[model samples]
Target chain A: MLLKVKNLNAGYGFLNVLWDVSLNIGKGEFVALIGPNGAGKSTVMKSISGLLPPKSGTITFDGQVINNQDCAVNCRSGLSYISEELNLFTGMTILENLEMGAQMLEDKNKARENLDFVFELFPRLEERISQYAGTLSGGERKMLAIARGLMSNPTMVLVDEPSLGLAPQVTDEVFNALRLLNRQGLTILLVEQNVTKTLKFSSRAYILEKGKVVLEGPSSELITNDHVRKIYLGT
Target chain B: MNNSRSIKAVEWLKSSGGITVTCTILVALAVSIHKGPYVLVNTLVTGGMWALMAIGVSLLFGVMNISNFAHGEYFMIGSLTAYYIMHPLKEYLLETPNSFLAFITPVLGIAGATLAGVIAGILTDKLIFAQLRKRNREGWLLNCFLITIGLSIILINLHMLIFGNTFKGVVNYWDVPSLALGDVYVSVDRVVVFFIAMLAILFFWYLMMYTTLGKKIRAVAQDENGARMVGIPVNRVYSTTFALACGFAALAGGSLLFMFPSYPTVGIAPLYNSWFIIILVGFGNVAGAVPGGFMIALFQVVTRTYMGEGWENVIPMFLISAILIFKPYGIFETKVRSVWEQ
Candidate 1:
């Protein structure tokens, strides 16, 4: 396993959000974590990405325990987190935002290489590089956010609700991009709301509710499971 | 492309950059009609110091959510640093006019004053603010303000104990005579002070725009969590930023020593001036402080000329109060770098 979590218990200062939650992801696996609002899906991503410290249990990434490590340390150690809020420096230009993303890439040559890759990943971003991010269209901003996450060229990417507040067509375009990245051998742990689309492409899926993992299995098997069909898929 | 370009142009006019250009033209026009070169130079000198001090307050508030009432003390520290070092070296230089020590003493004092402010700022952050940052951040803004208040009181009393109420100062740093510009004589000291202030501001601009640490500070300023996600060390950035802010305050204090003098309560007027500029800009932006400081200094000069010397602080306060009541976001623009900014 490239990432492992065991009985993780965490929350926001006395408000226990995650309860003994345990999960794993092998290298290069496309995994989906889906749940209702306030089901601790985002919290799980926050803890694993080291944005929120885990009160108990352990998170080991690439064979090293990474529990309670600073977020920057996690990013430096090959982990990139694209948050739901899409924290792109709105006051700054698209080019500057991308440059900030590559700040930790120690090797200037690799950072330059990644810059080319990012511009290529989203040609729209390249064209509008000089424009302030706040001026970008919704779809372009989402693309910029994802492109920023890729600037580090991380080993694993944890993307939380990349489709939030996006149109269905734009959402499809985003999912396609994610699918393309996953195909190129990037380990992806996605927390998404669109369950059917997520389960269809993700190799494995974890169903969380009330801050605990209630069900976990292969995506293909879980998609047909009666409990998931009733509560989540509305089939 | 033209459409987008126009949009960007419009955005620029709304930004701090646009405001600066507009204010410069207006001030220049007003100068051509009424104010002479001497008045212009005076405004610039006073304005430059205020800009340096106000920039620190604005950046600290915008980034760390700190309302540092104690910021004035850093200014005092600079004054003290320059006074102690410059006095003896200056005396020796005056006795022996051709000596190298006299030629370099002012520069050394200036450098020492800024360095002292930075050290004091960093130590304060590491010893006090760093401890508070580790705990829960609820009411964090209020807590920080209170702590600064306590710090201001403690520092002021400490200054009284050590330095007493002595008004230690210099008439000027260099012995060079004032230069005449269009029948108006401009003091060499004021010219030198303005030059240093501009240099410091430009250096600050370069640091914020170009350096890696500056990028981190800007990132953290915009969004701390976002910066952390990109692997920027937020805590260290905070400490460095605080030091930078204090360093500027110190620089301002040392540079303006000839005008303000060094005393226990000397910082009080400077503190008020900084707040006036901060409020006038009506934003949490460092860039706005430059023009805003100049604008306030001009207002002071005008009020001083008409109503004698005492109304300098009084009228500005009343005007600001009126502005706060009517257009609270700020008079120049309704910019949102407010401490209460969500």
Candidate 2:
């Protein structure tokens, strides 16, 4: 397994979100965690990425125990998290935002190469390279945020609710980009509210309800399961 | 494409060109009034020093989102260090058979001041600011403000106790006889101070614009949580930024000491003056601090020279207040707030 969470429990002050949530992802695999709002999807992502301190349990990434590592250390270890809220440095230009993503890398040439790759992935970002991230359209900002995460060339990517505020067409565009990246051998853990779309893209799925995983299996199998279909798919 | 191109052009004009034009016009006016090269040089030099302090204060606010009330204490400490060093060194260097030591005294004074500034920065962080950071409370700023005010009072009193509250001028040894350029007399110290201040500002500019550390600092300033998520070490950046700003402020203090005399309470005027410059330059725009410093310094010099000392006090107060009312973001704009939001 590339990443494993054993009975992970976490939350904000006085409010517990995750309780004994155990999950795992294999190397280069695409996994999805889908649930309704307040299902602890974001809290899981935050705990794994070291944004919030986990109350209990272990998070092991690539053979190293990483339960208590800070965000910077986790990022350096090749785990990147893109939060639902627009976290792009709004004051910075698209190019500058990408540059910041590649801040930990020492080689300028490597950074330049990554920048080229990111621009190619999102042509709109290339066109708006000098434009402030704040001024970008909602769809474009989401693309920029994802593009920034890609710049770091992480071992695994944890993307939270990419479809949150995007239109259906834009959502398709973002998912397609993620699909292409996963196909190119990047491990991905996609957290989303769009059940149909997430299951369509991911190989494995975990159904989270109120901080605990109620069901977990191959995405194809779970999509057809009566419980998942009724509870999540509105079948 | 055409519509986007036009929008981009408009933004470029709105953001960069307007500020540049205003600064140029003001500089030209100052030059025109003082036809003598020395007078112009002196004004520019003094302006650069004031700008350094303003830039330091602005950067602290930008990154930490906290007002550092103890910033002026950094300046005072720097000048005091220089004063202490010069007091004992002047006798030894003057008595030395060689004149070289005398020539090098000012450099040593600056070095001493820089060291003192670094120490003061570390202490401020470790003793006071760090505690606030841990509390996860916003009240640290208010606490720091009150603490600094109290610290300043104690510092001045301590200065009175130890240094006897007497003004001490940094002794000059270059004796290069002032260069006579028509009506203005230019001294070597003024010329040296100008170049030093310019170099310091340029160095800071390069660091903020081009270096990795600079990028990290800017990231934290823009969004602390976002920066940390991206793996930037926020605490290390904060402490280093504080030290860097204090170092710049100290350099300014040292330059001021070279140009004038120092007393325990002498830092009060420059501290007040820098507060005006900080606002006039915009809260977080370091680039604006340079011109803002010069603008205020020129106002002081010109008013003092032409309209007498009485106008020196009146003009800065009026100009700063007027500018704040009209352009609260300052002469140079910063990203701390959106223009549309305002």
Candidate 3:
């Protein structure tokens, strides 16, 4: 498995967000965690990505236990978390933001290669290369955030709520980009609120409700599951 | 051509009115008090140092979001170091008795002072700020303030115990004849100190505005987590930024020591003045610190020269309080939300 979480229990200041939340992602697999608002999906991503410390249980990525590591270490270990909230340095230009993401790479050549790949992946970024991230629209900022995450050339990308606040068409564009990235052999764990769409795209899905995983199966099977349909899809 | 000239004349007239009013007030006060130009010059030079110290404090707090109560200690360390290097601490330990070393002492003093300041900054970050950061403490600003205050007290008392409370003077490098330019008499020492201060500010401005390191510091200041996520070494940047702030404090301390006598308690006046200057300059804006410092210095000088010694205390207090009440960000307003937007 590229990433594994077993009985993870975590929270903020005594408020537990993830209780016994277990999930796994194999190498080069596109997995989605689809659930309602405040379902602890993002909390799971935070714990796995090392943004929030896990109170109990273990998170192993590529055979190495990474639960105690810092966010920077996790990122260096080839796991990038593109948070739902806009995380771009607003004062910096698009190029500077990309350069910041590639800071750990000592070689300029490798940074340039990543820069070129990100720019190619999102051409709109190239056009607004000199513009500050703050000036970019929500959709552009989201694209910039993803492009920044890709700059490190991580083994797995954990994206949280990429579709949030975006128009339906823009959401489709972002999902398509994720799918294209998955095809390029990068493992992706997507935490999303767009339940039906997320389920349709992923090979496997975990339905989270109130901090615990209620249902887990192949995406095709979960799509037709009665409980998931009633609670998530609003059938 | 005639119309354009008229427009230009109107714009110039409108802008010059504020300057004229200020100049008129200064003249009236100067005439009424009838103080010597020497005292006025002294106040101006001392005020400049205060402003410089304030700039450092504001930069650390406004940009880095670290309170750094230990900032005053850095200034004190710089002043004491400069004094010892220039004068040679014969009372403390064995003296080298090298005449050449004595001649180059001021430069060595400044260098030593800067080094001490840098060391203090690094130690604070490693021992306190870094630990707080790991625990996910958001009240680092308050903690930093407290830590720095404690450090200042400890350093001051230690200096008193080690160096004693006696005042010490640095050997003036430029003790040449004074220049008489019209009614204003400028001392070579003051001129050199003033020029050096200006150069240091210019150097800092250039570094912050143009360099890659400056860009990274500003990026981290904007959003530390965001910067970290992008692989920027946030802790490293924080330390470097703190070091830079201490370096500035050291420069100001060295310059102040050169102009005046130093005591263990000398840092108190500068620290007090810096508080006003920090508020006078828009928080986190280094460029504003220069003008803010100069303006406050100018005000202090003119007030002391024209009104009396009492106005020296009253003017800065009133001006700073008024400015804070009206524009808490200082004379220049920076986009505060931009710092948190990331």
lDDT per model, in order? 0.87, 0.81, 0.78
Tens digits of lDDT, candidate 3, B1-342:
999999987775564333433564575457435766665566556656665677678778756776556676778888888777766543222355555654455667777888887887777778877777777565656766787788789888998999899988755654356788677778777866777677777777787767778878877777766766666677888888778888878777877786556777777766766776766666666666665665666667777766887888688899779877976766555545432333
Error of 2 at B169 (Å): 2.8
DockQ by candidate, in order: 0.75, 0.61, 0.49
User: What is residue A13's positional error in candidate 3, in angstroms?
Assistant: 1.6
Q: Alpha-carbon error at A71 in model 3, in Å?
A: 0.6
lDDT of 1 by residue, B14-127 (tens): 875476557755765576467555657778899898999999998898888888888899999999999998988888776777656756777888888999999999999999
- The candidate maximizing lDDT is 1
CAPRI-style quality class for the chain A–B interface of candidate 2: medium
lDDT by residue (tens digit), candidate 2, A1-235: 9999999999987899998999999999999998888999999999999988799999999999998898888988899888887577887888888899999888889889989988888888898889998899999999998988877779999999999889999999999999999999999999998999899999999989999999999999999999988887888
* CAPRI class assigned to model 3: acceptable
Per DockQ, the best of the predicted structures is: 1
lDDT of 3 at B45: 67
Q: DockQ score of candidate 3?
A: 0.49
Please report how far candidate 3 places residue B246 from its true position, in Å.
1.4
Model 2 agreement with the true structure over B1-342: per-residue lDDT tens digits: 999999987776576436544665576476657654544675687788888888888888777755666677677778878877776788776566456766677788888888888777877777777777776554655666687788778777887888787887766635458766687777877878888889998888899878888888988887776787777888889888888888877777776786657777777777777788877767777677887787778778777777887888688889779877887777665546421221
Q: Each predicted model: what fraction of the native A–B Cα contacts (within 8 Å) does it retain?
A: 0.76, 0.59, 0.54
Model 2 pairs whose backbones collide: none
